[model samples]
Target: MRAAHIELTPTEDDRRIARYAAAAIALSVVEAAIPMPLPGVKPGLANIITLVVLARYGWRDAVWVSLLRVVAGSLLLGQFLAPGFFLSLAGALASLAALGLAMHLPARWFGPVSQSLVAAFAHIAGQLAVARLWLVPHDGLIAIVPFFALAALLFGLANGLAAAKLLEDAGRTRQ
Candidate 1:
């Protein structure tokens, strides 16, 4: 009997996946650059990239990409440990969970639009819960939920449309 050795090689698909992840990270940075009037609120344009990654690569990759985006984005913004950063982190985690659940759903049950909507809602709920429990002791922040939820709806739709377009393009290229 002879000992066997194995070496790994990067296939074309692996290279493509790496490129996609890089593109998603870059998109996340750009999304973080956009400013909103309210504090700790964002359209989370990077989520579109996460959604596309989830649809194409699956849940694990999406979670990794999303976590990377949140951590890197927070560092880049110099917001590490700030309330906003924690809020964003909470939202990202919730969004990842929601996306994972959505991926497990029947294909016909929820399209990208509905998936994004649900994820956005979950993200908001998570952030609100964290804010109430850890950041703010009083219920003053509760008043903003409706406004944030409305914004989430609009931004979620936009993110979903962008993700859908990206997925369509990726599918076409694959074919």
Candidate 2:
């Protein structure tokens, strides 16, 4: 039996999504290098890309980029199929769900900053839930919620600001 030849064609939108996913993966790699004070408290730099993609493209494309980042980032970081990978996957799913709802809010009231804040919290909540139910299985795990929430708030705000600035610059350059 001969192997079948395969042809793949990528549209502009596909290329755009790939580029965004690659950028997010790059950010994840860089984030993994940074030493974190807490185990799960690294700055989510890739989320900035997710927020930008969500704003510019849509939730579908954002989902593609976010999920692609989680999978590819895990493979690159040697965490594929590990507990960390599942945690990351759970967080991405939660964040995407939140973004899906948030994107529907009035544009004047909720932009990238507000959306990012919401997604960040959802991301942490998903991770905590997974850790509690699957990894830790201990009631004491709830005690760390405050610390993670603070980190999520701070990092989400910073990432949101960065994304907003990028969007602003992109808008200017389009003129």
Candidate 3:
């Protein structure tokens, strides 16, 4: 018996997405190295890439980049299929939903900063919900909301500003 052989051709978009995903994954690794004051309070540097992609490309490409980051980052960090993986998955899904909605807002009014803030809150909310329902299963989980919210605000704003700068630079380079 002979097995079937298949070949897939790569499109320009596929190469672009792969490049973005690689950058995100690299950033995730760097983020993992930073010392965090709290367990789930990394700066989420990779999300800057997501925001940039969202602004420049579109939500669909952004989604692909974001999910690839989560999956590939988890695998790289040796957390695939673990509780942490699920938590990350939930947060990414929630963030993507928020981005999808936020993208529809007026571009002049709600740029990367506002969109990042919205997605950040949604990301933390989704993680908390998963932790409460599955990991802790106690009302005690509520105590961490304020902390996470603060982190979300600070990190979201920072990432958004960075993305905006990158976008600005990219635009300059293109012209």
Candidate 4:
């Protein structure tokens, strides 16, 4: 029996996805290098790319870029098949889902700031839930929820502001 051969054609959309995913993965790697004083207090720099992609493209492309980042970042960081990978995947999925819903809100009222904030909170929620079900499996873990939420809020706000500025800059470049 011969193995089946398949060829895929790359389109402009595929190139766009590659560019966005590269940016996300690069941010993730850079963030990993930063020393965190606490366990769940990451600045979530990679998520800024997600917010920008979601705003510029749509949820579908945003989701693709997010998942690709988790997978590729894990492999690059040598965390593949580790607990960190699972946590990252869970958080990405949750955030993407949040972005899907957030995208429906009035774009005028809810821009990158709102979307980024929502995704950040949702990311923490997913990670906590995963920890509850898998890692610690302790009700006491809930005690740390407030801290993570606060971190998420701060980082999300920062990322959202950065994304907004990037979008603004890109708009200027296009003109």
> Is candidate 3 or 4 superior in lDDT?
3
What C-alpha lDDT values do all the predictions have?
A: 0.82, 0.95, 0.94, 0.92
**Candidate No. with top lDDT:** 2
lDDT tens digits, residue span 26-119, model 3: 9999999999988988788889999999998999999999999999999999999999998999999999999999999998777899988999
- Where's the lowest-lDDT run of ten residues in candidate 3? 107-116
Between prediction 3 and prediction 4, the one with superior TM-score is 3
TM-score of each: 0.84, 0.97, 0.97, 0.95
- Per-residue lDDT, model 2, residue 93, is 98
Query: After superposition, which runs of candidate 4 have C-alpha atoms over 4 Å from their true positions?
Result: 1-6
lDDT per residue (tens digit) for residues 71-91 in model 1: 777787788788988888899
> 12-94 in candidate 4: lDDT tens per residue?
99999999999999999999999987785689899999988988898899999999999999999999989888889989899
How far in Å is the alpha carbon of 134 misplaced in model 4?
0.6
- Model 4 worst lDDT window (10 residues): 36-45
Clashes of 4: 0
Where is the poorest 10-residue window by lDDT in model 1? 13-22
